[model samples]
Target chain A: MTTRTTPCAGSEAAETEVILDLDDISLSFGGVQALESISFDIRRHEIRAIIGPNGAGKSSMLNVINGFYHPQKGTITYEGVVVKAMKPYHAATRGIARTFQNIALFKGMSTLDNIMTGRVNHMHAGLLAQALYIGKNRREEIRNREFVETIIDFLEIQAIRNTPVGRLPYGLQKRVELGRALAAEPKLLLLDEPMAGMNLEEKQDMSRFMLDINEQYGTTIALIEHDMAVVMELSSRIVVLDYGRKLADGKPDEIRHNKDVIEAYLGVAN
Target chain B: MFYREAGDFKTTYKADQAIFPIALDRWFVVTVVLVFLVVVPLLASNYMLESILTPVLILSIAAIGLNILTGYAGQLSLGTGGFMATGAYMAYKISTAFPGLNIVFVLIAAGLCAALVGIAFGVPSLRIKGFYLAVTTLAAQFFLLWLFTRVPWFVNNSISGVPTAPPRKVFGFLVSSADSDPIDRYLFVFIITVVLALVAKNLARSRIGRMWMAIRDMDIAAEIIGIRPLTSKLTAFAISSFYCGIAGALWSFAYINTVEPTAFDINRSFEILFMVIIGGLGSILGSFLGAAFIFLFPILLNVMPGWFGLEISVTLVTQVELMVFGGMMIFFLIVEPHGLARLWSIGKEKLRLWPFPH
Candidate 1:
């Protein structure tokens, strides 16, 4: 894979610092190659969309980025540190947070509690202090809770704050999942099909949330999305993958006109 | 109407995050504590204190411990009796060795000892879950009991393998010896149980509690979002065992005044598990409710035949008790899997919407 760090022509490259760089990352499950020699860089404060058809290894790419799946080959550089392999805890502590392809909210916990779990790394009180629920523990809880309330406001899930996520509808659960990921105050957010199974109205709401998250928080996002229209509208840049291989990489319009991407993913017109 | 939360506005997160956020709940808890402290001691007979309330409180602690692991952390364990034995034996050793140590310090030290053992047993939980982890803990149960029973050192070289509680005093009042006043023992166990239950409630609402629940709900997602499964699972085991240990210590020192390894056998573990399940898995109140029901129901069964003027034999009563307990377990599992605590909460919810139907 060639170095493709230069932003496509006609796009702003002022914030050119690469927050995460996947260098020749290859992963497989026995005989099947899930992601082969995929090199990509997620820039700071950019909505980097990973677009692919079925079996294109989009989720696999996100999994590798978040340290859920360690590649058999290559290194992942995050914040300029070349990490050969990362534990999910290490990835999360280093400001990498993600939402899953299927909504993975804690089903037994209240929405507020689910979001509060995102701040586990930030909590430092000892067992005794927490057991007593006084002084430092109480103070830390209130402080983190205040921060979480802001995310609750952003996601507009205040009505269901105390409702268990399992009881919520799909769109609301997805929103709660987003709220949970956002609560981590991540430097890079990996979203796997953030709008999957949502109606058009929910899709628009999620798209607005993605744009607002990118613009307001200045968080770098790498998303695996199947909705072409949503991807075109939300992503600053797009990477096309086909059969565990990179097909094309460029701005949304550039990928839209890429012949190979059209033939492989969009399909050819008669 | 009595359970209504109307006009109870919280202006701060601290108030909002309170264990009893509702003003009515706070008042209700305060009233219950007052009754236990001031009224129950003054009114209850020696038999009532020793056989019923005291055992309920002690077993409630063990139930809470099991609840933290199975109910909240989602790690099924059958090591409650074994961990309790560890605590009971540890307390015996600590008090006997120290001779002049306060009972509070002894209890805490015993609980710590049990927590360490719990952590060791908890290590297997990292690789195994559900019934498999339960089976591993079942091994802990048998091994711990066998170690205590076979090793004369645990009973301090007693021929009968029974360790007796030496006389211990708290605030100049005898609390541990068999000759101690029943009221003093009841109060001692009651105070400790109340404080420990509050602590358990606090832990359940804190970040650690959230971590346990996260692991319980979906461990993969929990790890991805950065909850260390090892620490969470171990802490659950440690805290649970600590509670069980304290309960065991009190059982030997205060409630029974003498304990054999048989006191904390497989039957005891199953009893506590029953309490946790029937009370509520993830609720602190459920632990107490479960303990009360399991302990009192047997006594009630024994006396119930007399009240009805029936000529039921003792063996028949025992058989009926076993059958009824089994039937109730199935009934609760199917009707209200969350246990009696969930039922209590549902009642409160209904109270909030009284005089109206939605």
Candidate 2:
């Protein structure tokens, strides 16, 4: 059934559902054609997975959506506002956050401190506030600490809160990276290969976390993963990119049965 | 274990952010400061006071400045002595030209001039980093030093090209080079150095200091975090050169008395850098430690003759002092890679728990 209905009076749709529309985005990196006419639409509260093999431009596609790499052609409209060529920080400040393929936590700082740093843009306290550290500044600092503590509790990293991020295990590091991203309180969370190098148990835990983030917080998640089974289980809609092109876009079952997807995954099923 | 913060509590933020939060560490610093100010002056001979304490303190201020730019901001520089020369020569030209002007005013004017020079050199930091930046600063050092020597106006057409710091009264008391009593000069340098050190310490904990440290740690991350690197680095250079200029003014007015174009030599720049390295990168206390070590060595070298009951020429002793200084620098680099500041921190870490250490 079509979910579309007549526009209701005295109600704002933006206040309810968010739209992430990437329209005919074409991008090239030097001699390599990284993405060609790639288009995808992500709705609020839905889990969207972009699954593909290595060198399939999956990461590049995500980077484009988040404004890390400005596309040579095309437009990305988030919440009805078209995003032009802008730096990564611009996206960060505008309620969009992402975690890297390799965990990019500030290694020298504590896990709690690393997460707290993610709130740098959001924090109203400036340099003067930092220096004098007066009434409101102290209050803000306490507030920041409290906010970080909640994330630490959510991730169950209370025991290692004071520990440096560099010394933590890889799975824990990935969790910390996720914590940092979540610290930004982004409306759209982009996870690039979140389960890239995780063990089965870790991957399951991450999937649960992702689901919790979606169901509990109502955050829209766009992920890139190699695990087909996990992708089928988690995503309502799957985006398959092959050689800088969208090979398949449909429901989990539809993608699973698609002959083109089968050919792309198993090389003609030989 | 003894060296744990298991029970020692910091109820206040100020306490937590102290230069040394531990009670024992605090006392140790107090004790050291007391020894330097009160005990040393009484015990040490006039010649020792004149020759060592004053010079080391002056150099310590300069090192702290360089540490701000190079150590904290990650903008490597080799033109420290040139900036120092800028201060010294400018002070000389001004003080000699306008004998009626307060010595303090001349020193400040000289510092301002050196700050301008520092900013000029700092412009290159925007274009380069690491070794390339260091080489560019080295060019500044060579050029500035050359200017002082080649330009006749700098020395006021004096045959010797080294201006003499005339007998000058500060608040009705004559503090002058004509006295030749190094004690009075040492006292003047001591008061100024302490004031400068306190100011530097305050500045370090300021907004600019955090910005510099952020840039130093990771520049790209810093930019994204909203810190402008150019603004932070240039400010660091200006403040650092200002200190170097002051030190240079003190070098001529208090210690050297009559300076030459070669007075603010390249070796002096290396000496200041070594002070930071041996003391600790990004540590004010380290600069003082470094200066004290360098300052004490030459005097100890002078005293070796009386202790050993041997006759070594003063020139040979000075040469040997340089060799020993060079050797000690290498030894410190190998022994404590993080410098004396790290050693101090480690010692404090152990002492934090004291008798209960595992």
Scored by DockQ, the top model is: 1
TM-score of chain A of each: 0.94, 0.92
lDDT of 1: 0.91
Model 1, A1-270: lDDT tens digits are 122243222136425888888888899999999998999888888889998899999998988888889899988998999986788988899999999898888999999999999999998999889999998899999999999999999888899999988999999999999999998999999999999999999998898788778767878888899889888877878999999999888889899889998899657866
TM-score of 2: 0.80
lDDT values, one for every candidate: 0.91, 0.78
lDDT of each residue in A105-190, candidate 2, tens digit only: 66656787667666766556554445455555456656766777788887778898878788999999999889978877888899
After the best TM-score superposition of candidate 2, give how far the Cα of residue B133 lies from its true spot, in angstroms: 1.7
**DockQ, Cα level, model 1:** 0.82
Which number leads on lDDT?
A: 1
| Ten residues in sequence with the least summed lDDT for candidate 2 chain B | B220-229
Q: What local lDDT score does residue B56 receive in model 2, on the 0 to 100 scale? A: 85
Model 2 - which docking category? Answer: incorrect
lDDT per residue as tens, model 2, B87-132? 9888888888899998878888989889999998899887788999
